[model samples]
Target: MRVAIVTVGDELLAGDTVNTNAAWLGERLTERGVGVERVVTLPDRVGDIARVVNEYRAEYDAVLVTGGLGPTHDDLTMDGVAAAFGREVVESEEALEWLAEAGGYTADDLAEGTADIPRGARMLKNPEGVAPGCVIGSVYVLPGVPAEMKAMFETVAEEFSGEVEHVASVVADEPESALIDRIDELRDRFDVTVGSYPGDSVRVKIQGGEAEAEAAAAWLRERVDLKETGE
Candidate 1:
């Protein structure tokens, strides 16, 4: 499965808050063998949110958005998401019922603001909090709080599944240029996508079948070495 992540928060864009959700979600997705194609953090602006939402929703198989979900002025995620799909917002009965069970909220409390989801969206149950998320098409609206967002994601367990086995490894002691031909060779040999991420070390992600991954692993062990000079 290929997925895109949208982290919505002024705090994150302004660098006041670390984007732990992005990293955490990416790690979880990776361990699940899903490929995260992109991750972006946007300030709480309708135009920005809508642009990103529409773009990613069309580009990737799945879109996951986190933050701006509470009953606060800054929480314009639902509105932006609605605009992205050109849909109206309405209170979700499923969310209303779920909220009542979680916090004893009256219908009034559950009828406004937080419970307002994009029309025709599927409500994603948030067992950790009262505000429920919704999945419209491939777009997912999740809570900002990591704990709550994770719970909401679990509610849609069947949607995000990875069919391919993938793995990554680090190699240093040589320039990344050294791996250019090696990467191409591996791609042709295993029908895998090998990406070279440069930094203090070179992180090569090998994504393909289990047999191909094993083949790539054995090939690398025999031909690749890491001495940490620079790669």
Candidate 2:
């Protein structure tokens, strides 16, 4: 399935922190055969988040939104997602229980800020931290903290399915310029795409395809490994 990612936070938009979550999640999704079609960054703006969430839902099969699920003021990811789906915020029982335990919110501590969520959203428990995320319509409001987001993601990964398997090999002491053209050509010949990664040692990543995986591997062995071209 095709998916889009929305990372919401002031830190990301202001460049105070690198948005490693997107790249990391994208790679994971790719490895599982899911296509990460789009990645978007937004400030803690409710209107902007709602707009993008609504727009992308029409284009992609799923949209995985991260950031802004904290109790602090700038945490507005849920609000935007809720708005995008035209829903009202309500206190979630599952969330309340999880929050009371996970978020340090007691019965009295379950105030307006900590226990509310969009109506009809399926609760995605946050065991790593407080601020439980929810899935409103097609938009999934996830945590901004990498650790929490990853934890929450692990709990719900099976729901988003499109499984991709990739195979790659390393070519020591080779230039990507020497391989790009051939790799692109191989992309056509093989059922999957070939990408040449540049570094002190080169890496070639071949996309997974049931029909062409073995053949593609054989071809790479011939051109890159067997002769040790050293180009």
Candidate 3:
């Protein structure tokens, strides 16, 4: 399955906060064998979130949106997501009960929009915070806070799964330029994707079906003096 990730925050654009949510989600999703097709960061603008969510939903199998899910004024992700599907944002009684029970705060004591969510969306419990995330259609809305997002994702992690590719990595003593021809030959001979990272030493990564990846790794090992193996 291919998924798109959308992160909403003005702080991210201003370099006040790092966009680690996207990277973490990408790694987790990739580990589950799901291909992350796109990672987009946007300001906490309803229009931009709506447009991107609308567009990505049609293009990808699923869209995972994070950030702008707090009770603050800049938290406009839900509004934009609601607009994407022509849905209304309404106060959810179930969510209110969750917030009250989990956070020990009554409805009156909470923020104005604490329990507001897109109508018809399934609320996702946030184990790490009071503001719950939700799922609308093919889009899974998640909190921006790294801790809350990671905890919430575990609740629905089983929903995303695909064919897992085998991965093998090796560190070679040769320079990157000197390995291009061999890398190309390996790709031509095996049904695997190869990546070469240049540093003090070249690190080559091979990914594909188990047999193909193993074969490709072995092929590379025979030609290049590998310093490290199996990453």
Candidate 4:
């Protein structure tokens, strides 16, 4: 499955909050065989969030949106999602019940719109926090809190499964410049995607389907003496 991740927070855009959620989601999705095509970080504005979510939903098989699902004023994710679908925001009884069980809130308090959700969206149970996630169409709304987002994602991870990827890597103590031709040759010869990282040693990572990845690795090994980094 192809997916896009939308991380919503002014703090993230301001560099106050590191965008670990995007990285984490990318890793988790890849491990599940889902390819993450894009990642977007936006301020907690209803229009911005809605526009991005709507755009990605049409472009990708699924869009995982994180952040802005709290009780605070800036938590506009839910509202943004509703606006994207042209749906009205209404107090969700399911979310209100969940919040009541989580404590610190009464049914009447939640009735005042603390547990608002987009009409016709399915509620995603949030075990770690009060704000429940909701899925409207292919867009999966999630809490911005790392712990909460992780938990909610795990609950529905099966839905995002896709073709399993095989990864192979070549590490060389030589500079990246030494392997440019060989890397280009590998790309021309195989269906793998090549990624290069330069540091004390240069690392070339190859990713593709199982047989293709193995063949690419073998080709690279035959052409160059790859360093045995054991990484």
Best by lDDT: 3
User: Each model's RMSD to truth, in Å?
Assistant: 3.5, 3.0, 1.9, 2.0
TM-score of each: 0.83, 0.87, 0.96, 0.92
Q: After superposition, how far is residue 39 of candidate 3 from its true place, in Å?
A: 0.6
Candidate ranking (lDDT, best to worst): 3, 4, 1, 2
User: Candidate 2, residues 18-133: lDDT per residue as tens digits?
Assistant: 99999988977876778898998999999999999999999998999999886678888878888898887777888888776766677686445666689899998987877788
lDDT per residue for candidate 1 within 41-152, as digits (tens), equals: 9989988999999999988999999999856888989889999999988888887787787788888654358788999999888888778888998998999888998887
lDDT of 3 by residue, 51-159 (tens): 9999999999999999998689999999999999999899888898898888888989888888888999999999999888999999999999999999999999999
Error of 2 at 153 (Å): 1.0
Top TM-score hit: 3
Question: What pairs collide in candidate 2?
Answer: 32-164, 33-163, 33-164
Count clashing pairs, candidate 2: 3
The clash count of every prediction, one per candidate, is 0, 3, 0, 0
Kindly indicate the candidate among 2 and 4 with the higher lDDT.
4
Candidate 2, residue 108: Cα displacement in angstroms equals 2.3
Residue 73 of model 4 has an lDDT of: 84
The lDDT for every candidate, in the order shown, is 0.82, 0.80, 0.93, 0.88
